[model samples]
Target: MPPVERRDPEPIEAYLFDLDGVLRVWDGADLAAVEARAGLPPGRLGEIAHDLDRYGPALLGEVTDNDWRASVVGALVADGLKPDVAVDVVLDWSANLGRVDPEVTEVVAGIRAAGGQVALVVNSTDRLELDLVVLGLDLAVDTVVSSARTGIALPDAAMYEIAAGILAVPAPRCAYVGPHAELVAGAERIGMTGHLFDGVSGLRAIVETLSAR
Candidate 1:
């Protein structure tokens, strides 16, 4: 909701992105689509995923990856599906992931062309590399900082510090973009310019203007 700091007189020397909302989206497996794939009625997967108490730890890496899958499988099997079938559905859903936003891809590439540094700063599981490969937008940014591998998550100062360190840019010199206000707030807390995603139209214009500078 705040003004885009990319418009500030101080030139933004680098850019960083969040995973789920900004660049790589998990739209490939929304509740409706997963229901069709798992042959379960709508709202089943939704109920489980939104169950913060059960699956939240897995998502935040508090639980092991296997434990997370087991939790999902147990829920599916309890609903009368066979173990093998549940496993297949869960695996399929997990593996497919999401597609890259082309606008973000273009903006990142444009930043690179203009000699700006770009990085992917995300809090996710160890599948970060594979996720990037699937989205095929790893080519857009110069580096990535994934919490699954880094053992850090957003709203944590360490996560932002690690990303800025990897990019070899000071936090104040980097512009952080994400969908969540809280997550962007984390970056801002570290003195990075934080921008909430409004859509590609606004983001592209900012990207272009910054690169032009």
Candidate 2:
């Protein structure tokens, strides 16, 4: 295959990124394991996992951790599992899953080497500091903004605003990269350039091209 042509970034000052599907691949294995332990069907677990992704973070803004746990437990109970079993299953599943992406580290390094500032903006229930330590992603990026800490998540616009504020750059001058189109759209809507990254090489090429431009 021919080399991918990259474009230079518009004299931008910094970069922002999303985690999960962008920097890391979260396979939802934890949710699957929880469902299996609860005796739920394969597809059923995926459905609940979708629901958690769709509603859990938003709900977190209004509910306590115990309340969120209760809600998940209640869903399991409705699916016919005992509440205690449901909670234990979920916790166990969560504990077993770990970060799977290492390419992100190189990409972050390239961005920094290019003299660009980078920050992580992720929608996560776990604390950013703890998760970074657990996943060992702290050395990859300059700063991290977790919804659990910022009280906002992707596609909300506020998360990007908060990130821009924290990075001390106008949103328009910052480039936001992620795998999700919605996040890209959100960045565009907020006046930032957005890149949908497929891998480190593609992302690095894009950044270099943008910088050259």
Candidate 3:
């Protein structure tokens, strides 16, 4: 993809960041280790955990995090692993929340330093708060809007709307960074400037633009 340019027509007062791909960086080796211990093929556990039909309710706040994990474990058990072994494997896999990206951290700090607020907007489960605390990101932003907490997820406009409202900023004055094109488009539909987060450099470019304003 080409580099993202600084193209916001209006001054942005706040930034809405996506949690998983934008701020948190996953380590494949950790996953590989967990899969090895479980005698499962690489990516199998993740595939099961992210299966939309099984995970949709969790993200929508209809189920607890424990319920989601239990469902994944049950699926593994049905695939021939002993129930106890499956539970252990799921626990280990779920514990790895991944590390924060320092570059993105710098960008977030820069935005705040420039008088802009930042909110973490995510499609997540009830475990989000715990995971944020574990990753030392609970205080990293001005506010957080989780689908599990709001009972709404992107590309629904309400998620972005709630984040902007929390920051006391108008939707048109907020900028969004996310990996999914659909989510980015959703934010744009609500009048927020949207930057598709293809990489750190693209995000940095957007930050630079916002800072220079």
Candidate 4:
């Protein structure tokens, strides 16, 4: 049998990560508990909070975080939740400090050890910066670009460009790790190598391959 030809990996100078599903995750059980206490169906809060129409302004920074939460409360009230109860539920939900994947930090360290820069590019609300601090992730990455801060959301080419610009690397020299196929496609469209992250093990493999180069 003929020897199979091996293709060399492209040069990757930086890594861009998606924030929510890639690195940080909220507790589903806690959310369910909140819903149960509020007499709302499971996952109802997430559906209401993340509905594109209601969330767009918040993600774009056109509305304050407080305003967005108030809108959620209003939605709950309209859904037959007592106004006070809705307020309390949202307040408790807001207090949720999502757990960060420790393995992601290890992967980040590996990337940095290999002379690669890292940045978090997220489509998130205005409170993202503050949340990072509270979550003890402010220093985890070299930089962070939130859609709310820039008024540009992912899977947009411009957002990836911004992160690449910050890292002082060309988009083609960057690797983007995101949980969604749409986001990965967006990164690839802008010439970046994209990895759809399923787990830390998959991410670690990428880091190992890049580090070996």
lDDT of 4 by residue, 1-213 (tens): 999999776688999999888889877999999999999999999999988899999999999888999999999999999999999999999999788888888888778876789999999999999999998889888999999999989998999999999889998889999999999999999888899999999998877776666
Query: Which regions in candidate 4 have their CA more than 4 angstroms from the true location?
Result: 1-9
lDDT for each of the candidates?
Answer: 0.77, 0.75, 0.92, 0.91
How well is each residue in 89-150 modelled by candidate 2, as lDDT tens digits? 65775465356476777767777887888999887765445667777777778788777776
- Please identify model 2 stretches exceeding 4 Å from their true place: 1-9, 28-34, 49-54, 57-60
Candidate whose TM-score is highest: 4
Q: Each candidate's TM vs. the true structure?
A: 0.83, 0.81, 0.92, 0.94
Sequence-dependent TM-score of model 2: 0.81
Clashes of each: 0, 10, 0, 0
Judging by TM-score, tell me the better candidate of 1 and 2.
Answer: 1
**Which pairs clash in model 1?**
none
Q: List residue ranges in candidate 1 displaced over 4 A.
A: 1-9, 28-30, 37-41, 53-56, 59-67, 209-213
Model 1 quality (TM-score):
0.83
Q: Rank the candidates by TM-score, best first.
A: 4, 3, 1, 2
lDDT rank, highest first? 3, 4, 1, 2
Compose the digit string of candidate 3's lDDT tens values, residues 155-200: 9999999999999999988999999999999999999999999889
